[model samples]
Target: MTTVAHTPPSGTRHTVADDIAGVCEAARTHRAYGEEHSTLHPQVWEALRSSPLPRAALPKHCGGLEWGAPHIVEAVRVVAAADPSAGWAAAIHAPAGAFLARLDPPLAKELCPPSETAVAAPVIGGSSVPAGTTAPAGDRMRLQGRWPLVTSAPQLTLAALAARTEEGTRWWLVPGTELRVEDDWDAVGLRGSASHSVSCDTLVPAGHSVCLTDPARIDGALYRFPLYGLMAACIAAVAEATAERALEAFAALAQTARPRHATGSLAHLPAAQEHYAAASARLSAASAFMREAAGQAWHDAVRGQVENAARARLRAAGAHLAATSAEVCQSVFEAAGAAGLYRSSPLEGCWRDAAVASRHALVAAHGRRLAGAQMLTGSAGGHL
Candidate 1:
């Protein structure tokens, strides 16, 4: 499964999709190293650099593929099945690109060059930004805030910061050099994700900013999507892939790793068999649910039918997928018995990753309630 990226001759263009398999293979082979570094393996990062996957959701004029939402979700789900950290890291690109699409063309081009990569961290709960008394100077604004859970901060060239101004909430693109990343990403799972807090105290040109929910400057179906729903789909993709990996790993382990005092392999055990079947069925259903929701959302957006109720349905689908995937991972872990408990076992990693990812704000328990409320009340004005 080992694959390495190669250099194309000058003038030969390369895209993220070109490196997808190599990245997945590298991530799969170097999962332990990624966990140790609390970030993607260097090789995986390099592979992603040559990939077009990151900007898949952006308009073609911006060097993106303008992929449908369903396509992006499934691609992310497949990647996550290899390495959740890679999956999680890659999934952020769509939303990041979606935001980038709203920026003025020249600025978007300058900030998001074809070779450049960026990640985002929204200001959540409390504000860490210092209050400024002066208005932004022309096209430049100074920022001073700490954003937590910024994935892949070490590998990115830019970061999208969700901030507050006197006018309202907005998003700004800040160069990586202007921000400080703290090594505080230690967590129980998905340790490979360098999801540390980043502090910024620098000026960014006004061209690099946009209203958070403004109609995208680029006309396309992807730009029509609500940021919340896109984010939910991204996180759900990770959960779905991790669950799939756990089930596959457990099935493989059962073929050879017999239970204590068992006559045959664990695969023959009634309990293991039941667990495998049940978990597989559950994961399949969740995968279908997630894809369907994304597909429907994409369909509506393409036809200009995107509404709060539809967005709510998509969010609920993402949450359900996350919750269901976590359950499947747990089932697989329990079925593996003691063999699944060790750090050496992939099952342990899968379970940990699924558990942690399920808690992400995009797919948390509150999302389910919000979706229900939106559907019942026919309004989008609620917790996001």
Candidate 2:
């Protein structure tokens, strides 16, 4: 398998922002192909694999960037703005590296060696919800199950799948090559994410599994951040960025599109102007709230003082962002009139992508309910 070099040449430093820019450029260059083909563009995947964005949440000891939550959120935002599909993939796969910290040091180091030539930390993809069953087999576990909605399934080197054991639910780290990838994803939006179903009926060593509720062996601020919270924030960023792109596309269309029986172009219509202004304001407010929540959570993580209230706020902000962004996209699509109905229109694609993103488990209405329950009763039923 080919691997992307994580280290730059001698004396040439590559910042996280630079890597993010490169990924964004690649996403723009191949967005159309990915959208049409219903799979991630190879070049876009390569660019993302080589970039530090995927390693932003990894531990520094594992040669990861270990970026703060706010930075990670911003990186997803920029990439999503360039192409919503690429951004969705990034949001799903970026936090995967942090899971390695839960494994024993020896196995973690072996899987992701701390060397310049080692493959960029493997993109781990799988569902957290348990859909499989596991049984004890000597020093290993006999695993059999199928997980759905696995983003970038074909590209993943490892899968972090959850399975129900005799004891309880446990996460297993299985090699992607050992799993059967079913090309079953045919979603209307995020077509390029390759969120297919993966099934495996094989034995996995005991060392490859971890109970996520346990403390991570390798301690760090990034690892300290709540996994669900981070996932929600990243998902929210993609939704907000996609909405921003939709608004931009609408602006461009308004400048030239003349509605059927209108006095002038769409831009001159009072109703169109009102819709654009309202959508823009909604997006701006949602973006600010997301950033503020992410920043505060990161601040608490750095000090090793993260509170339940902070996590709840961050999750709430993410849910709010997803809902608001989807609303903004809907408003823009409606205001674009017949122009947005065409497949060639970027606004149309944005609307579709936002509609799908808003349905993600982390950013959906359930997330808000979880946050509200936590805030109101100081208990989320241990869901988070």
Candidate 3:
């Protein structure tokens, strides 16, 4: 019953930079879709399905392209410019191929055939941010839990989750049909992303879940790979892209449309030029650092860096760049003022998405603490 898709040729490889422009151009032309496209836009889904990188993360054993984090970053940057919510979904789903790759061969084949994109949704309710209890019932596991902030819940066909049992937090997988997505993600930003809560009060067969590791040993190369950190880094990298586009938009505006307070032309003003210069540098620096960190962590992973050192670098780089990206957006927004806050302005949504999504518990201050503490105590950081 599993249907896997085949891989595209390397000659057809689409890098991050290429994808960034693609998403940006898409967003540029289809900005209105952000408000009404998730359910309505079949073309959007088709455009995403065509991306080579999302399928690249899977291992060669399963017929996946199996590209590393650099490709991952590129794909993310591509979608980042288009829509953060889309990028965020890609951040979770694309990289999960590695986790999927680790599954028992039968389990991997059963759930994901070959070449097909399998969606895994993590719900955010119960004690488990993405918690659900699965007991045997018929051909499936009886699922019971609520997952709030389930990013891209509507679009997903799989849910990778944890449950509270007699033992502890256990992971399970629920098919998309078994779950119900709540109409609750009416937030200030990323509205296009249906990151709603999912009601998990149904049956999900055991065949759906992949038990990758014990909680104690979950600290393997997979866990150490900095999933959360990468998520944050992707968010930040996208924010940087948003800032870049906003600047371009603003530059276009300044060239023709005079500022209300400025005399004569807007671009000629010293203060405006300074603002543009400063924001640009911040974005450039943050992006360069993020790319470096992603590259380093990936190289280290391939080279067999494990548990501590590899993760520490990933966390340090992810957290630092993410934080910097947020700051750069903030600085640019200041220059943009009320016009940037217009409901029609992409900056508004990008800003809100950047702030709201980056606040994820994994990417927050505690993550930074773990990075710093590990750096001091000589323990591998929790990042890996």
C-alpha TM-score for every candidate: 0.85, 0.93, 0.80
Candidate 3 structure, TM-score to reference: 0.80
Best by lDDT: 2
List per-prediction Cα lDDT, in the order shown: 0.74, 0.82, 0.59
Clashing pairs in 1: 15-51, 15-52, 16-51, 16-52, 17-52, 139-206
Cα RMSD to native, each candidate?
5.5, 4.0, 5.7
Tell me the tens digit of each residue's lDDT in model 2 across 1-384: 001123466657554456677788989999887777878788999888888766777666767777666667677777888888899888977877778888877888766667453246667767887998987799888899999998888988888899887767878888888889998888989888888999999898888887765567877787777778888888988898889889889999999999999989999999999999999998888878877777787788888856888888888999999999999999999999898899778888888899999999888989999999999999873455
290-356 in candidate 3: lDDT tens per residue?
6666666766666655456555656666666666666666666666655566665555565676676
Residue 344, candidate 2: how far off, in angstroms? 2.5
- Model 1: residue 299 alpha-carbon error in angstroms: 1.5
Which 10 consecutive positions of candidate 1 have the poorest summed lDDT?
119-128
Determine which window of 10 residues in candidate 3 has minimal summed lDDT.
118-127
Question: Candidate 1 residues 40-117, lDDT tens each?
Answer: 788887766556566667656566666666666666766787789888887776456676778778777786555334
Q: What is the clash tally of candidate 1?
A: 6
**Model 2 whole-model lDDT (C-alpha atoms):** 0.82
